[model samples]
Target: MSTILFHEIVYGPVHSRRLGISLGINLLPYDGKLCSFDCIYCECGFNKDFRTNTHLPERENIKAALEDKLQSLRKENAKLDVITFAGNGEPTLHPKFAEIIEDTLFLRNLYYPTVKISVLSNGMHLTKTKVFDALKKVDEPILKLDSAFDATVRIIDRPNSPQYSVSKQVELYKKFNGNFILQTMFLRGEFEGNKIDNTTEKEVSAWLELVREMNPREVMIYTIDRQTPTKQLKKVPLEDLKKIAERVKQLGIKTNVAG
Candidate 1:
């Protein structure tokens, strides 16, 4: 199984197709994966295969590490567009997630006021009060919604909670009040002998309906950009992704396609 893991608390100012020049903050363990959803296409690979023996970085450690990196970058005058919260898993899962966000905000203002703060989440913990509030504070709360149907979500995201449903996710997203950004990964192939393709007319139509309801500030539509854990999966062509983006644009919501 191919995987890419961040083995540090604060990692690269890597060029992100969606978020731009981003300095990553890995709130999860430095050794393995920790996520609510075991996505087949996750570049970090499946959770079980990358069980972590390490602990989540303490709030103080994260703050210290981020400040140190920022100070160093400032001295060098490095170009950084955003500080992104994403790692092996769900960042909101951190116990002091809200406090950490506050620390990050302060540091961002002190170091790079113009730089944005983004959180790339699976939206599994949005119902949590702290997580919701923390996400609200960020510039881009990029939450994932790979499918509009519960069945399709289960197959693609494979959320840990058996009760996780698209309906619940939609309601949680509604709480954002059009303040969040909806991100969807479009792909097709077989998984465990089951054929999967979320770009179908039926799927996209249902997704567009939900998009209309959520009315997010923006929609990020993209296909697999990195090697996925599931070899059977295939990337949706750029033309198809642009077609989807056009549908989102028709909804009057800004759409960013990373193909």
Candidate 2:
């Protein structure tokens, strides 16, 4: 099992295979991963291992740290392609998430106006109007939707919300009016005692139908790239990902593959 975690509030201008020169903004926890979903393929390990209701950084502190980093990057004349709001876990879980978004946008404009701002979220908070509005303000709202089937989602994402449903989330996504990007993780694995594979015809067909409905700007189809907490999982091949991309493109939607 991978116990990978980010240890800072603002870390990295790391090179990303999909999004180049990405600077990461950690809004979860400095010492652990806190997410709404305990995904089997998460590099940050299981959610229960580091679950907590305390030690969340204040909005002022996060803003200060982010501005400090941005100032240094500006001094160095660093080339940053995107400021990604993603770390060990979900970013919107922060209590002051909307405020943080505002602060981040202000800093980005002040220090690097041309650079894009992105948020990598699980989309669980879209029902929260503040979070939804905040997402609408970002340059890239990369929302996750791994499977259209609730049964497969339970095994793959393990969403903490008991009332979570694929149909409900699809409706929430529709509200974005094609401004969002759909991120889906493709993998084959066995968790506990059940076989989990989200590449079947039914899974792809149902997911594509929802994708057509949402009509997002783009679809990111990627496979596991690191060690997962669940040892039984296997990464889907790049060829398969390309195939999925082709199917997605058939709907007149652009697709990007990351693995």
Candidate 3:
């Protein structure tokens, strides 16, 4: 069995393909995971195992701890690349998320001024003004749009609500007007007898159309980099990812692929 990677308040300055060495902040609990979507590719496992009513870190405590950590890293002469808001679940779901962002900004200025702040969000909460405003403060708000079709989204992402529509989600993304980094995970396979293939021509066509409409600043085309909840899921090869990247580049859209 694979042990959960991020079940704590702070994780690694782990090697990240895009963010370089990143210091992770996990606002969620160290045992259970709490997320709006139960993605098949989530490394922390599904929202079922450790998912339940739980307590997240208080905003002030998070700030103090982060400040202390940053100061310690500085003393050790350890280089900090990015302070990422990612871990077990959706970081934005914290009630004081906005205040947390403000505190992070202040601490970054005081200690790691050169470090960038990035949040890996599911884009489910982007429709909220508070979430949007708070995320706007970050250096990069990389939002997820795993698929363009509502049915495919429901199947793959398995969001909390049945009424959730991918089209509406993309529309909310468009409201950002290309201010965000759009992250996509490309793959093909089956999960529980349902055929899952997001790399098909039809799927790619729809995704590209959505991209054209959103006009994002950049797109991160990555694949499964960790263990997943579903065993039957497949990974997209790096060479094929490069081909997709090539097509994205042709559209004059910046893209980075990590397979």
Top lDDT model: 1
For each candidate in turn, the TM-score is 0.99, 0.97, 0.96
Model 2: residues with Cα > 4 Å off, grouped in runs: 52-54
Residue lDDT tens for model 1, 144-181? 99999999998999999998999889999999999999
**lDDT tens string, model 2, 1-259?**
7988888888898998777999998887777778989998899999888665658888999999999999999999999999999887899988899999999999999999999999999999998899999999999999999999999999999999999999999999999999999999999979999898899898888889999999999999999998988789998889989998998899999999987
Relative to the true structure, candidate 2 reaches a TM of 0.97
Query: lDDT per residue, candidate 3, 122-171, as tens digits?
Result: 98987779999988889999999888898888788889977689888888
Q: Name the Cα RMSD for model 1.
A: 0.6
Per-residue error for 76 in candidate 1, Å, reads 0.6
RMSD to native for every prediction? 0.6, 1.1, 1.2
* Cα error, candidate 3, residue 24 (Å): 0.4
Candidate 3 Cα errors over 4 Å, as ranges? 1-5
lDDT ranking, best first: 1, 2, 3
* Residue 233, model 3: Cα distance from true site in angstroms: 1.3
Candidate 1 residue-pair clash tally:
0
C-alpha-based local distance difference test score of model 2: 0.91
Model 1: how far is 140 from its true place, Å? 0.5
